[model samples]
Target: MGKALDNVYKHQSLAYKYFLYLISVALIVFFFPKGGKFKYEFQKGKPWQYENLYAPIDFSIKKSQEEIAQEQLSIRNSKTDYYTFDGSIVTTVKNDVQKGLEQWFATNTFTARQQRDALKIGMDVIDNIYSLGVFENHPGSNSIIVVRNNEAVPVAPSDFLDLESAKRRVSAELSHSAIENRIGLESVIQTSLRINLFYDEALTESALEQELSRISYTRGEVSQGRLIIAKGEVVEAENFKILNSLKEEYESELWRGNNYYYIILGYTILVALVLIMLFLFLKRYRNEIFKNNNKVTFIFFNILLMVLATTLMVKNNESYVYGVPLCILPLVLKNFFDARLGLFVHVLTVLILGFVVPNSFEYIFLQTIAGIVTILTASELYKRANLFISVGQITLIYIIGYFAFHAIHEGNLENIEWILFGVFVLNGLLTLFAQPLIYMFEKLFGLISDVSLLELSDTNSKLLKELSDKAPGTFHHSLQVANLAEAAANEIGANAMLVRVGALYHDVGKMEKPTFFTENQVTNVNPHDDLPPRESAKIIIDHVIQGIEIARRNNLPDRIIDFIRTHHGTTLVYYFYKKQQEMEAEVDENDFRYPGPIPFSKETAILMMSDAVEAASKSLKNPTFLVIDEFVEKIVKGQMQANQFLNANITLKEIEMVKKVLKQKLTNIYHLRVEYPE
Candidate 1:
């Protein structure tokens, strides 16, 4: 049992123990309504080869979305409503009648009773006419006939003359009365009244919408045991409509029962299969990532986060499905892993999402194409321009995919949903924000990306600046090592940016005791000569420990600090040990060796090789091309002979390439032209 466990986990840590727990959570999240998968498949405008089908129950026929929209349009075109009444307008007319009558009677020397009679006649005139409410006249017509609660009332240009007719009627009816009173009544009626009606927009719209809600969506119905489509019959629009209607009603049938737990378990198994495959792939080919649960968690978490977003969008509405930024997943994952892994994970996620979305084929196809474009074009992610170009290409792919499928389904572009193109555009704009999001993931997941590595490579950074100030010689040495390692990494197709950053900060431990090292001493005085051999070696080896402390103090990523820990490895400090042995009868060799786990990756291994070669070349007696080339070869060969790079996944071919790069780079650094003319 112990042997089997050892093979599974080479070094058991607390992080590895939680692997099962995290996978459990991932399965729970992936669980959806998936226990019962439809057994049959059919496509519109295609021949059905399956056996004849019968309705399982009395499923009601549902209206297609287009049919529902047309019905609603018809109802809206015929709907009409009116405000019915306006009390404020009646008050205004009454006030106007009073003011006009009082002014007219003030000019006459009429008795008090005459004024009273005059006011009564004017008020009665306005009240009588305005009782019939006015309505908006239709354009290019004489007047409008408004239907108020099944009562038709005609309001015309003649209605404006009602007060005029009222004036003549009152004067004749009151002819027997005094002339002064009749004249006052006539003036008041003309001036006091005008149209006192307006269209009520808010309430009128409410009433019309209330009426619109009554339009029934069902134009027709399909009875139970109805023949939908027979075997080998082509599914045209008529049969397609009936099939869709049946599918809607069948899925929504609650009386048949649904086992929620069984459904969850089924989906969990499906997601587990895909994720376990990912784990096995990583554990076999990339165990470093597999053992580190944080990296695995980061990848799985990204997939889950994307799936959750998609599921939520579908739950809200299927039209929201296109608005989801599915392309953004591959674009982000490619930043940390290889393009193949990114594409694989994206395909799996889109496949799972297919069961949730309405138009599964188009949803998967457009997103899969977008993922491919993202992987192919999103190179040099540190350069903002590359990311921008990749986003534009991804959006263009989505638009073309949408257009092609739209034309295929509708048989023409006439019914194309132009808004879906806008959705793709929005998705591209969201993808451009990935630069900032990279930083967030790095912090949250404790992982680094190429974009962060670029920022770390700057020499003016805090730790690099301290190294330059305290130990200028060590600082210059780090720069040459960075350049050499970068070039070597490029030749081997390793992570060049990561190697360069690692090389720059590998010797930060030297900053703690700078004067003890030969390069930083820069004087006749040797600090190491004053101390015992064991003490001198101890100080030399302590740099790796001190560098790690300082790096962690400044919150450096664990990935970068890996270089400091492994650059020296467990090799002996031969110069000090040999000196101690010649002077003393006996010496303990372990005290003169640096404690290390050795280089464990291509980047760290390259750093180790570059550091040893660059530091040793400074001791050249008289520099020559042949001498420098031999010097580069000897140092790398010695490290290899000691099996220092045994754990790092590097090949002899890659090491030879590194040797060639170092030799050419060192030769150029000290290249001298012939002095024959002088």
Candidate 2:
């Protein structure tokens, strides 16, 4: 048991990698829909590509969403409007009209017979208005169903009297009356009339909903063994509907009982395969990232994020699936890593999403093309304008790709969904968040990107300004080395920005004792002359060590610190060491050497070569092109022989390229112009 535990502890990293793979696969598969996938692909106005298909079992042909919506709308338009008739209101209005007419007659000098006739006429008008059913307001329907005495009866809207119509009726009836002061009697009747018909919103809505529910979502049925479509047949409107119904039914019925577990297993295997491909890709091509668990986690986490987002969108509403900023994946990865890895991971993510999204072929094609555009166009993420243009281009590609697919499916440009264009534009805008997200990832995962590198490369920064003030000559030397290193890195297709930033801070340790170095010696008094050779060597070698401490104090990223540690790479301080050897019989070499882990990447290796050649080129007297060439070649070749770049992932060919860049840059610095003879 102890041996087993020890073995587990020894291989913990390997076990952790497998655990990441397992968890990623589990999460992706868990989010995937449990429905079985249909084997056949079909589209309206396109030829069926598969063999002849027949119904395997009896299934009802379900109506399309458009058809169902049309049916529901028709039901709404043809629904019966319901209104409740208040008989009690009519009786109350009659009594109020009688009392109003009697009071008016009492106030004026009217004969008893005249008062009796006026009260009878006013009550008659009120009764007539109420019989026609005075409405509170127009119901906005030509016909209505009136509920009275617990029975609903059809009634014409014209039969109901609104306030204006009721007033008109009262005026017309009073004008024919023989009673004196007919206008007074008419006013009393109008004042007493009230609305007796009220719209029943609840009843109307319930009735409409009932009618809509009765709509037949399934128009017909296809029997078992019926031929649905033949190979190479054009999928017309009817054929497309039938095929979709069959697909829906088949997928829904396929995953039942034990088949559910099999579907889950199938999903697991496919997810595992895709993840395995990603792992193999990292292991083979991006071994550095594969070795680092944090980097691996970052990559997988991005994939999982996109998958979760896409699955949620599809589940809630598939129409808005394009609104998700999937292209952000490649953009973020390219900024943090390289374009190749970014594009590769983007393709794998889109492919995984294709398994769940509708129209797998079109989805995969559109996303894959968008990923390519993201990688190809997005450069210098630190620059806001570059990212904006790339996102615009990416959005335009989505629009065009979707347009083309739409045109193909419908066989024309008509009926194209214009809302999806807005979604694509929104997608582009969301992609701009990749910059901030990259900053967050850097903080969370302890990684660096070009954006941060650009910030670090600024000479006006606090640390860099301090370095320039304290060690002006060393700062200028670092500038020259930066230019040379940047040019070399660009020529060899390495990270030029990273190398330039590293070059800027490589000699920051010299700021501690600036005058001890010759470049900072303004006068001919050498400070090293007063100190012993061994002590001088110690001072010189301590710069690399001091730079690291200073960097840590300033919170510089580890990537930048790597350059400071490896710039000297254990090379001996030859001037001090040789002087000591002449004085003593023997001297220890280790005391004169700089502590180093050496350069381990292309950027660090370029900085080492650039630093050594730029510092040495200062010693040349009246240099020419040939002298500079031999000088640069000798320095780089010596470093190569001493195995300065043995651990770095660099080649001899690249080393020669770096030497050439140094020679040319030095020549240019000294103004080596060609002479034209007359």
Candidate 3:
């Protein structure tokens, strides 16, 4: 009945898993921009691979973006207008002339003849004033000019005068020039005249901008069937401009028709192919990851996260797309898995983004090179300096790539966008914070990383510190095992850091009753002498079980807790079982054996061997290099003959290498040698 229920559930689970995959892939592809890539990708200096390129539709050949921008600037600078003010103050000066004539009669300061002359000159100066507005030297103009009802009116530099100039001009132009200069009639005319014209700056700006909008953008026409370029022809600046115009017009018209749905379908298939390849890779090389639904979900979740963020940026504008942290994907992946997996996922992500972003060729080339560099440099980021160095290299790679692509498009650095260099700098600075992001993923995804291992390996950590205080002897033994395992793992090309950390915490179960284990029994008295062999074996076997419990309570990662449960295989406690065999004719061997699931990886298996060898090496009374070597060989050989490593994913040659590393380390710890005199 149980088997039948499990079979039914297994079929249902498979259907459910595949259903979720379909939904995830479908949702992502649905939101993708509906378009297909051109049949060929070409560069400015590169030769065209396809047959003669012809314009299929009647489209105008657009000017280069740089050329368009410069033309726009020229138009704005050319039509800039100046402020104009009409001479309405001339009418007020006429009224003031009557007041001045009356005031001259009342004051009696000037003679009747002088008053008549001053009034006549002041009246003439006010009437002769032209409707002119004066301004300082303006840019892109020989003289200050103002727009009047859509016509430009130029003002000579000396046309409108200052108070001193106005006084001198009014006095000099008088009918009695000699008598007017002596009488000083300049003050009377200067006071009556005023600056009636004023410059209106804001109004002029609006008129200039309106004039700039009238310029046309198209350079020329490319009628249908016109050959733009032939096969094997180098795409020069003019050819590139026409090709881009064709590409833009083609995309704009194609996406509006029913065929776009089919384009979406093609994109869906392509994206699905990449994701399915990643899944199959995990199933083959890292089946443990494939089996865990949570891990599979986390990997897909990151891809979705990057895709969503990148799409949002691209949707807003192409310039803002640079701010999206592309390297964060590979940095996060490399922290959790190996470099190959990181690079694989990064390439898939960039390929999908290529369809959404502008300039597909440059985007793909830049991101691919950056992803490769990130994978190669991002190792051992536990040290803070390594993180800085890696981020620096990734940022440098992005800057260099942008320069190379820019040079290809413009044929020189003449049209380089310095803002893009700034954008790459911003991208690099954002990448430096990936260390904190790795910590965030650990909390959010329930994942463990080497950064976590380095933290757990600290002797000052709570668990390790407690072990040292309570079970000094066992603590010492665990330390020696860690040293041996680390060296062995390094020799055999396994995760040396993981095995070392595992060895340190593997014996933490002995902390529950430190005095019961022989390593912690400082007094010569044995605690197990009071109990039966079976009961003593039960206590010994309980450590592996209890160790797992302790590790879990401490919130250590499951990857670490696994080492505690698998260090001891289902093997007998030899000394206690042998003593029972001497007293009883039939001693049940199972009662004296450890309840065990053997090590399941190279690092775990190395830990088991290191633990046994380090503990046994303490029993040699007169240890020499030869004795230690033979002793190490005997213990490792015994475990192999008993099939303790049946499940560990390691080979005979690797085990021999591990054995050699163990002997070398143990001999150094115990074997005595004469010190050389300095």
Candidate 4:
């Protein structure tokens, strides 16, 4: 039991990594839609690639979205408009007419016969206008449905009378009348005429909506066991619709009861496999990052962020999926890591997204290609112009690739969605945010990127300026080391900017006692000469520790501090050690050694080589090309023999290449031309 506990404690980091992988998988799978994926892949105007297919079960053939929209629009345009006939108004107007006629008759001096005739004419006109139904306003449609007696009756516009038409009718009626007081009768009839018909907005909208709802989403049905399509059959528009209907029905039914768990299991397995592949990639090629749980978490978190963003966009609206800026993943990863890893992670992310986004093939193709373009073009992310150009190129690829796919699917550019171009442009614009995001990640995750390295490499920065002020000699030495290391890094295809920044600050601890270092010693003052060999060695070695304190105080990133820690590795201070050895029979080697975890990265390893060679080169007298080459070889080869580079991931060939760059640079510095054989 104790052994088991010990084993668990020893491998806790490994266990934690597994837990992270599981959690990432769970979170990704959870965000994925719970629907089962359709089994077959088909596209309009393309030949079906699968085996012969038949309808497994009966399902209504769903209409295309465009077809449904067209049907709805037609219903809205041609549907019957509803109007309410206010019968109460007709009754009130008629009563008012009768009373007005009585009052007029009482005031008039006409005979009772004339008054009766006028009243009859006035009532007749009112009846005529009300019979046709007076409208308050003209209906938009030529025909309207008037609701009367709790029943809708279709009426034509000409069949109804507005106030103007009602007046005209009243005038005609009175003119034909033999009443002596024709003008007075006309006035009474006109006053009695009131609009009883009104447009029923609520009823009209409700009726139109009902008609629209009645539109059949499914145009027809396919029976079970019907041969849908044979292998190599062209998936035309009609066939595409039927296939889509089957896909929807199949997936919907597949997600129903016991199958739901199975679907989730399937998704979990897929997502787990993808994440595992990423894990394997990091473990194989980027084991240092894999060991560092924080970096591992940062990578996984970025992937999750992109996936979550894309999933939300897809759920909100599939049409905006392109606007999610998936290529930003590659850009950010490339800035923090390398292009190969960035492209690999981007491809894995896109594959995971394929399970959720529409048009899996098209989406994967476009995004994978865009990621490649981003890695290829966005090489110099520190430069804003380069990033802008890269984003433009990525956008252009998206547009062209999408256009090609669209053209292939539809067999014409006529049906291409031009709005997606705007979406692509939006995607490009959002990709520009990768720089700020990289900066934020650097702060949050305690990671370093090229942009930060670029900022750090500036000589005028606060810490570097202080480095120059107090330890001008050491600062100049650092500059030489930086130039040498940067050239070596570029030759070896390592991170040149990172190595340059590391070289620039590698000896910052020398500032604490600058004169102790030979490069900073001036006026023939030898501080070390006054002390014992052991004390002198301690002072020299203390510089690394002091530099780390200074860097920490100034808030330098751990990555830069790595250079201060590992520039000398654990190699002994040979000068002080030899001096003490001459006096004593034996001396403790640890007392004269720099406390170091050693260079554990290519950049740090290159800095160690560059720092050693540049400092040693200053001791050379009348340096020549061959002499400088031999000197560089001795220094680097001595360090190699001491196993200083064992922890770094650099190869012997790369080391040789770095040596070549260092030798060439030293030769140029000394202005030494190649020797000629006479």
Candidate 5:
């Protein structure tokens, strides 16, 4: 068990650990909630009640009881007693009938008391008319009609047809109607006073005129509370205005606050926070792998790409459609990491991003399947120029994924055609255009990109040119080392470009003192030939530090500089150390070693192994494929046993694969073969 655990740790690298940490951060942010819930309710009534003044009321009156006992019962069955009067007289006659009539006329006609009593009665009639349903009540105005001697007179609204006005109008009506007995015609005349009753509210002049034209019974004239008529009669207006007013009141009540304003604001904040959290987590995770250089710009580009995808997803989510083409990301990762780890992480990222997007389960499943296919297809195939072939290959995977997804879901084939066509276009775009798009985005936003691996392939890089000019043999050796490193990285499904780049610059310090390095010794004379073995060891050991300084001075990337500094792995300078021991010289083993923290990352580890293997293989006089195989296996195994690759993420199986690939590459570089009979 201990051995097994040790083996596991042996294969782990810092790069891999940082990669996992990034994923963990993404998971943490995706689940954070940003909004709280609240209960909502709507009320049904106004805060205040209004009185309805136009309610219906009966206006009929009944006969009085004294009339029925008098024996001359003419009128009956009135709803009100005041509506009828009895017809009998109890007074005795005078000796001359004309003299008696003259005397009765003198007693009642034109007298101050009699006129006052008549005017009082007219005013009472006007008040009663207003109380009847004929007149409607307005909140601020009341209506009345004026009459004088049974005739309605024209008057201004301000002129109340008070008792005086009523008497004048009634007397004028009586003169016009020519009624002989005032008492006998009182009931008939009062009926005339009730001529045309309508809404008796005091309206504006124009409104009053308009309303007056609509009434057909009596001519309406303006008075204190009513219209005066030529005849003393009133009619009631129909009531419905109360309900109309009530409906208007209710409508106003309903137009109060909607509460949706607060709801919208709350929802906006919640959605924004959730989206921001998602972006923050993803950006942080990417930063763990990419470090902080150009971080915001890289994050901006990724977010823009994600936003575009999210927009498409939202537009098509309802249709169960997703538009991200094949597993281009997995190919990218595999081109950048171990095939197995790349596949696992790519699938995870796809699943998580699917949730972030508004896509259905079908999209998630299809993307996973397509991503697996692309990664598997490109796993161990690491020719940088051939990266595009993986795109076409992924396109085929996309077609299969799209059709299979729709077919399983029982979607209509005809409707699926447009989506399939769109998928094709998206595939072409992601494959052929992703790099250019990333490059453009980098320029626009000042982003640094991981997409352009081939830039590391520049043979005319400053360090390479420096090596070529100062130490031609070392330059040639660096090229061979690059070939071996690239092959090993390809075999393990790692970044061949990164490995190749590192290999090309690893021994750059040897250029500073070309004679001290065996590879650059052109005159068959070694600088160590004159120097003591300990001094020669110190020179070799210092070269790693010198290389690092030179690399930093030129502002090379950390990735390239790391390879230059760590490619030696603190191993003892065996030749120099052994010679010192033969001379019985006491020296510290550390003093005869190259100073190194070891190859801490997969790219650096691969660089160191390939450099050692390629340089050591050159000593064989008659190198064969088997000889090259043994040499590579020995170099890799020695490094593994010495714990040089202890913390690196390169797995045991991957190490074996690297060894096999290195052997093949070295055989090719050396043209190793058995000389056959010909």
Candidate 6:
């Protein structure tokens, strides 16, 4: 039944996941409203309100003709019942007819070309008709005047100003001007004239002054009968709809800016829940490694890491920022799995969030950098007081992400500064906040979290301090193994620090029977010295199982427990197995072996290799470079022949590298060479 259920769960189609994702996106788009506008209103020397207000005119214009037209309209609309119109007449006149008897000067001019050039300027001036609008009687009252028939032809309204006097004044002004010689009218007829009218304030005030002096003929009294048109064109029926809607749309957009904020809020909640669900799923399979109460703590801390990662991915626009989230999952997983699985998780999360966030290649780069840095920095974070390392990791993230953002956006230093401030704040605050948030989430979801690592490494952690006091020899051995394994792993490009940390805790189970283990004894007297060979072998082989049980009893991480289980591959206990075989010459080799599932992971493989090499190197008689090299080769080769290296993903090339590094390190540790006398 369990197998059937597993098959059913595993075979669920990819199409289902994609369909759910599509539905999620569609819901976000549909629910997030995007039509809102806002306008700024100024009143009483203060911005009274930012409201939904509409303006009829757009005063900003780029075209010269449009600018000129607007300005002309402003002037024309400054008054009412009076219009100033400009019309042009195109005309031709006989050349040289008016320039008569200058007998002494003109007849002696040069060639036709010279004559044409000189004559051109005169004809150009004479060929144009010009009009002007003027305030005739008052500031607000304007009249149009055209110079025609050697007179100012008054185009002012007949009832307003005294035209005779106005015309005389205009004629007198024009007669002595430089343009007077160029004034010649062939034929004058008005074309189209567009007129704008508005109530002139000055005119109204003047009329009040001249209330009694107002010469009213056919038109009614100025104060009583005149229309009060606005200072600008009023918003009328024809164009009102377009302007009103435009204003409303802008208003809606501005006021509804919160829509995006809500989207982010929704995104946050959704992501957190997703991470929590993932944690829970992993927890259900927790029994696969070992049972523990700290599953809630483990899940909580990982979720916190994921949340920090998601926060890093948040951007101003909805462009993809996949790397932050992608990088995060692998880091959390690496704490629980092998490095290869960690990398796979990282890549998978990147691809998944890339689809979810709809980001570009830049998202991948930032996430990848963050993932790599986090993996490197936090690999040893299982140690004491290393939470600050996450902050340092975020700083690296800031630098890398800053350059990546700049590269993607084609930005420079100034953009870099803002990006640094933004991404740094995001990283730091999220990282800091992740701790508490994970705690809270664990409580809420009833989940396990890795945040316990911080507490587990505390100076006062009962188990660690107890191990140090009660089994100092075992404790010292653990430290040595940690160092060796770390070096070896680093040389092979695996997560060296992580391997070392796991090694430190791998033998914690030995604390249960400190006297039984050789390292925990002060003297070199073996406890197994008085026991039968099979009985000694049984006790020796059972330490791994005991260590695994102790790790679970104390709620240690699965990763640490894995090292305890697999660090000693199923090889023969040479001392015990050899003695038993000689005692009973027909003894089966298989019966003398360890309860054997060998190292199946790189970390465990590293631990096993390092543990054997470290212990064996100490027993070398008269240790020398040649002697150490010989021993290193023999041990590594022996493990290989026994197929102990089979399951650990250690490549032959990597094994060679590991051997070289181990030999070098062991030589230094043992002081294999004598120094020359100074």
Best by TM-score: 2
* Candidate 6: 10-residue stretch with minimal lDDT: 185-194
How are the candidates ranked when ordered by TM-score, highest leading? 2, 4, 3, 1, 5, 6
Clashes of each: 0, 0, 0, 1, 36, 25
State model 6's lDDT. Answer: 0.55
lDDT winner between candidates 1 and 3: 3
Model 2: lDDT equals 0.90
Summing lDDT over every window of 10 consecutive residues in candidate 4, give the lowest-scoring window: 115-124
Residue range with the least summed lDDT across 10 consecutive positions in model 3: 133-142
lDDT tens readout by residue for model 3, 242-274: 898888788778777787887777888888887
Q: How well does candidate 3 match the true structure, expressed as C-alpha RMSD? A: 4.2
| Model 2 per-residue lDDT at 370 | 94
Give lDDT tens digits, candidate 2, residues 283-316: 9998988988899999999999999999999989
Task: Please give the range of 10 consecutive residues that has the lowest summed lDDT in model 5.
Answer: 82-91
Q: Which TM-score value belongs to model 6?
A: 0.47
Error of 2 at 176 (Å): 4.9
Query: Which pairs clash in model 2?
Result: none
Using lDDT as the yardstick, the better of models 2 and 5 is 2
Global lDDT for candidate 1?
Answer: 0.77
